[model samples]
Target chain A: MIKMRLLNGQPQNRISMADRAFQFGDGVFRTMRCTGGAIEFWARHYSHLEQDCAALGIVCPSASILLEDLSRLRPVDAVLKIIITRGETARGYSVPDQLLPNRIVQLAALPAYPEQLYQQGVKVRVCSTQASWQPALAGVKHLNRLENVLARREWHDPDIFEGLMLDRDGFVIEGVMSNVLVLSDNILSTPKLEQSGVSGVMCEVIFDAAVQHGLQVEKRAWTLDEIKQSDAIWLTNSLMGLLPVSDLCGRHFQSHAAQLLLSGALKQLRQKEKFAIVDLAGMTKG
Target chain B: MIKMRLLNGQPQNRISMADRAFQFGDGVFRTMRCTGGAIEFWARHYSHLEQDCAALGIVCPSASILLEDLSRLRPVDAVLKIIITRGETARGYSVPDQLLPNRIVQLAALPAYPEQLYQQGVKVRVCSTQASWQPALAGVKHLNRLENVLARREWHDPDIFEGLMLDRDGFVIEGVMSNVLVLSDNILSTPKLEQSGVSGVMCEVIFDAAVQHGLQVEKRAWTLDEIKQSDAIWLTNSLMGLLPVSDLCGRHFQSHAAQLLLSGALKQLRQKEKFAIVDLAGMTKG
Candidate 1:
């Protein structure tokens, strides 16, 4: 399937040597989990992609075209990555007068999840690495992720699990690649991303779930002390769904309310969430 | 000449879909200018590239191997770019236990320089964008350069010229891609890069020249307020050599004792500097 896919896309592989994305880290991407026979959160994923592309003034490709291309590699379920970068430029910073962003989408097998760890949440710790404050680029999932790369490098403990990151101002931001939610005073609260943090897809699901269930929700600057004192804490992401924080540096107390809410939501969603196979040949090249 | 260059040691026609450079910005690159068949400052360029690769734990191709690829290009004088990225990762951040970093050496004709602008000097302005302080990555030239991209995006005023960047704490650091030196009270000073900024090769030369010419040379933190009062300011880089800053925003400066001494030394060295290109085929690829 992979060989044939490459052979067919040969004609559409005309990337100019001076595209700004290749020249500068000017792009955005989305990695969707296609399970069963449908794309998980397809609307939300493309919405975020288009929003970010527009924020950076890059042209976006049509979603139906992308869907058409994805129809070729149908094999139950797979992982799909879509990249849209600032298009060709004549070796300069100013985005050209007329812009047609280059879009490249690729497909791969879904990574096997560590189901054992998910049953009993993995050990989590706080990382020393801090994301710099940049309101100009806050919230949207842009391709400039060196902060996450550096944070991901902060740990090598195989026995350990996901680590939380804080901003330079000491505000607990989010996880290495996931979103965080705190159940404090019976309220669902997450850190605000006016300065920095990837606005996550899973996070939107959690928020919507809270709204439908009539749970009080809040979004604002959150400190480490506040998070530790919260009745319960959980991490959220499209890949991991939702995992309750069982142990934070050995201060273990199963936030009874957190366990109830997180478990209930995960159970309700997992029952409906399914992955689909992607057809690589049908993918459109921007 | 570039089309013949192979990808992954094969006669590939385009960049691979799985190249890590495209996926994660996981790479390091070096660009050098060759004049009259010889690459100026080859040793300095190689040293900086090697140090960065070592710091990032990226594999380093031997100088001989690099030259062999260069010899294949056979350009009398050209702009060469060397990009070595974690080649074919399987769609995740975890670098494989056994990884083979890919090496790409591209040669292009050099663009014409504005020598007259150098002779008359140029104007520069302080950019609103601030550089994030990453202590671990302060002095190395890695592929992650969004800060430079953002700062450079501030203007295209050919007359406005380069923009100076300040650290989060508002300390004068350097230009978008060049280092700045200020002269006052018969002393020449540049900002230290222990916390941020690329330690430019030209900066080291100017520091040594200051000592040889009997001028006080300083490297430490100073605010924009201090820089505004300097008698003379200049920008230095491997490509631009040493050029004076005639106008900084609303402020104008004239030649000073320290800049005079530094300029005189650079002029004499350029006259005596011997540049000889070695056969690229002679380079080793360990």
Candidate 2:
């Protein structure tokens, strides 16, 4: 899945040893999907990147600069990862007065996940590694992701598509790399990331579409039993899009009507945003 | 303060942007003090590094390899930082079948902290940023230190030497960059890092010496109120050694006898180790 990489808009594959991201993981990143040379939800992704960087006190690179870098790649049907680090500075946690954030944009082949899993839904297990509670870092998607790495390492079963992680208080927060939504009757609920978990962009887009679809959206702490009791469970990410959880432990969530409804809405949203970008052609001219 | 950097073993100053350390903070690190070209408590530091790597499933570089790299620098009165990452691999959280850990050894000038701070004690304020609860990650000096970075960023006042952080439960944890020890009468107490916090090597040495000195050692959770009522508080790290906190949120700690006693013991330990290294001269030949 590996391909080309650009550091600070140049065709470079290495960063300074002193770079804060390499040294302290002082950075934020966005993993976006680009199809037919057009990135899905470009505006929302840039906005989220800015917010995540602001949360960490690192200056966000301008959208034009990132767009220019993206244009350089002219990615077609690829996974685009944009990382903005606090840049290289002296060895310390203290943010330097002269903030020089470095932008890294890379392209990789879209992962070849089996289509049958998405169609029939996937099987996920509850991870033993619990998520840490950091209200400050919660929902920002900063680079301090060792917890997720550890959680993902729990199972090597190719049969398990993803792992569900809970906060220290035993509240189910999110999937190892995806945001989760629980469906019951007309209410669509997801865990509030105020104390932990990354507030994913795909989850945001889904919630917006759900509201327009006349679904009552609820965001709060979710217990494991509550999750299991739901009519259906949907895991969403920028790359994977959306996948229903058919089996969690021994319980089977056979109802996937909610997943189909949201998947169609998500496709509509992606197409609408693609047509809305005035510079779509210009974005690839570089 | 950075003087030199060695990536892997050679004197290189950059690493692959795909390195796990930069990519996901998938790494562990050690910061040690090198005086007279000898790393203080080298054996203990190496053991801690091995344990931390094992905790995160990253392979630890053998000590002789690291010591050989240190000898290449021939560092004297410098601060040494060693970072071991899970190495570069294809994208995703799944641990690859093959693991190639990368070692980064760098040298920075020994911090020139104000001399009087150790003698008269320093003033510290409680940080607003709370340490996250990650029992699995606790005590490992991994590179996912955005918590410490955010806590340290809470204040820029040079008058305040450090900031004390509390866990989600409002219990005193540790300094933003050091382990904290609370002294009340004959009891030398420190927060148990089982829930959250990095267990500093210097704190370990102090506790060992404290036991030998006939002081009762207790490790458990300590509340803010309990910390304020302590006789004196000391912050310990590899480089800064030990510093007493004379004032915390206006509560004064007049006792310095405990700090003095520990300081003496630490010096003796360092001297004892220096004489114990038979390869001290050979180590610098590189």
Instruction: Please give the RMSD to the true structure for each candidate, in Å.
Output: 4.0, 1.8
Q: Proportion of native contacts in model 2?
A: 0.85
Off by over 4 Å in 2: A275-286, B275-286
Residues B1-286, model 2: lDDT tens digits: 7899888889999899879999999999999988877789988999999999999998899998888787676687888899999999779888896789999888889989788888888899999999889988999999999989999899889888889999989999999998998888679989999979998899999898899898999998999999898888998998888888889999988856777799989889887655223254464553
**Per-residue lDDT tens digits of candidate 1, residues A237-280?**
87777777778778674646556565577657654553343433
lDDT per residue, candidate 2, A92-113, as tens digits?
Answer: 8888687888999999999876
Measured with C-alpha atoms, the lDDT of residue B114 in candidate 2 is 81
- Weakest 10 consecutive residues, lDDT, candidate 1 chain B? B1-10
lDDT of 1 by residue, B1-286 (tens): 2423434443333565465666666667777766666766667777888887776667878876776666565556677767776566566655665688877776666756587656677899998877766665678776666667768878878787789998878898899878988886777899988767787877777877788777789987878888889888889876677888888888887755555568778766544452455444334321
| Least well predicted 10-residue stretch by lDDT in candidate 2 chain B | B274-283
Residue A72 accuracy (lDDT) in model 2: 74
Candidate 1: docking tier = acceptable
Give lDDT per model, in order: 0.71, 0.87
Of the true interface contacts, each candidate retains a share of 0.16, 0.85
User: Can you tell me the CAPRI class of model 2?
Assistant: high
lDDT of 2 at B178: 89
